[model samples]
Target: MNVFEGSAGYYGRYRPGLPPEAVALLAGAGSPSSRPRRLLDLGTGTGLAVKALLDRFDDIIALDTDVEMLAIAETDLRWRLPAGVRLSLCHGAAEEFLPPPGWRADLVTICRVFRWLDRPAVLARLNQHVAPDGAVAVLADRSLWTATNPWQQAVRSVVQDFLGPQRRAGSGVFPATPEPFGQTLRASAFSDVTESFVPVRRAWSADGVLGYLYSTSFAAPHLFGDRRDHFEAAVRQVLGCFSDTDTFIEDNTFVIHLGRRPA
Candidate 1:
């Protein structure tokens, strides 16, 4: 069950883009002096990170398993790239994607979607494709469902009432990451791992929250089935109870883990 099959519209429209500071941090990691840099972005749903770093890379390969997600990403990046910046959108999973013969990337980035992949295998694949001096950056942040705000709690509770207490991924429940992402990276061929944190504050309207919910696998509109309208109304009511202006703030801590293959 591919949860992102038909949710690309919501994902492209609602999911937050990478913060400017985070983008700068990634760009500043290292730059090759001889030629333009190349980037490979795995699990690039809707291309948020790709869009942010397009200007810095000479060529970019954005890969994802969902066709709809790649379609939306293509549309989003169609006219946004700078002159001479080549873009290739591939449809595939991270575990099995193979770069072109002799291709190597200066940077490989996985954002928000890394937890769903086979970590060790993906890292191994990246190690083969990344330049010796290049790095792999995994970006992740706490979910809105885990926020401690009253409104966030109420909204999550309503979702639980409609769905269940556990998080849903397609037809199955999502499992917690087997171990800390850093630990997994360290255990892989990428042994030089470092981390950085960026605190982000955002305000969301009720509609924004609904859009965000629709973008995620766990509280998607399809989960409600025939009760989708009821679920929306209930969520609106819960949010309204706390937000007079129908806007709620989310304080998130975004983390980036950089992994480099030992020289």
Candidate 2:
């Protein structure tokens, strides 16, 4: 079973969008040129990054392995895309996707799902299609599981009790990235690598937290089998103990790593 098999609804409904500052940085990186502007978004879960960039690129290609995820993205983008923008939604993996002949992209973005790809192979593939002045932006951010707040800790404890101590994904445990993302990019064909960080703070309700957990592969609602409601109730009860206002604040750091291929 693929980790994201049945979680497309939760993912599309609960995942947060990229911050304004991060979007601005990506826009600023573009240079004035006569070449056709294209954007390729890999691991584009429910089209978060692609939607954020619809106004910036003339052509957008969004790729994801899950058919259901792409279907949701297609539905959302049909109304969200700006007038005159062309959108292409491809169902494929980052390591295996190939652009049409003569297709080159002005920008490529991989959001939270980069860890699941073969880094070197995908980077090599991007290098073949990235325009001279174009860049590849890799977005990395911590999930709610990394939160240190008391309410978050309590919720995590309840999940651990039901799902066991390991972080479950698909048929295997999630593996950590073997090396720093920056180091991996530096070793690739790209050059002029740089990193930027944006600090973000958001408030979440207990229900919002539950929705967010269900959106992830490790904690989807179906994982609880017939005890889904019971698990949610337990999480709600634990969160209620830590908050009087029914809201918990999350402070997150979003990191963007930009690497450019020589012109």
Candidate 3:
């Protein structure tokens, strides 16, 4: 069963892509100069990160658990692919993905989808597949639930009033604080782990916030069931109180965690 069943449209439209600086950091960690460079993007939601680094790799395979997401991601990247670069999309979860026989990935990237996966198991499996000198880079950013801005807090209150105090993520509840990504990489088979941060500012209109909420696992439209309309009305009311124009700002940081094969 697809957990993010109806979210493809909202996700493709509202989820922000990685900033160029973060993309550059990831690109630098890859083996671009090596011939037949390969990129394996696990959980490639909308192919956002892969789109940024398209030209850096010769062969790319994007994997995702949601079929609809793969469709959107494919449409986004297929036309932009450079000559001699190959792109393939597979529907599978990271924990179940196995590298093709004797084939190794020059770089393996896991973006926002890491928290939904079995962290230790995924890293352990990547040990056998990532190129000798290549890296496994995982990225994540703050969600509105963690934002500190006044308007954001108000919005959260409205969501909680509708969905209860606990956060719902698909079939399970979201962790109040999941273990840090960097710490997980450090304990894996890979070595020379390092962490970096990219500060980002996000601007949102009331409508934009509504669309983004629908795109998230915890606040997906399905979670609201028949009350989605009522929830949206409450969110807009709260947003209106905070800003007559319905504009909001979020100061967020993208955290990148990189681990590499042992030399």
List the candidates' TM-scores in order.
0.97, 0.95, 0.94
Higher-ranked by TM-score: 2 or 3: 2
Runs of candidate 1 with Cα error greater than 4 angstroms are 30-34
Q: List model 3 lDDT by residue over 1-263, tens digit each.
A: 35675788999999888988898898888676777898999999889888988988888888998888899998988999999998989998788888778778888999978887898999888888878878899988888887788888898888889888898776567756668888888889866788899999888998899988888877888888999889999999889887766678888898888888666
Which stretches of model 3 miss by more than 4 angstroms?
A: none
Deviation (Å) of 177 in candidate 3: 3.8
Which residue pairs show collisions in model 2? none
Q: Give stretches of model 2 more than 4 Å off.
A: 30-35
Best by lDDT: 1
* lDDT tens readout by residue for model 2, 89-195: 99988998899998888888988788888999999988888777888889878886667766777888898888988887754677874687777788887767899
User: What RMSD does model 3 have?
Assistant: 1.5
185, model 2: CA deviation in Å?
0.8
What is the C-alpha lDDT profile of model 1 across 1-263, one tens digit per residue?
Answer: 78754577989999998988899988876454426688999999999999999888888999998888888899999799999998999999899989889888888899878888998999988878888888889888877677777788898899889899998876678777568788888998778899999999999999999998888888766778999999999999999898798879998888999888776
Give lDDT per model, in order: 0.86, 0.85, 0.85
Q: Rate residue 154 of model 3 by lDDT.
A: 91
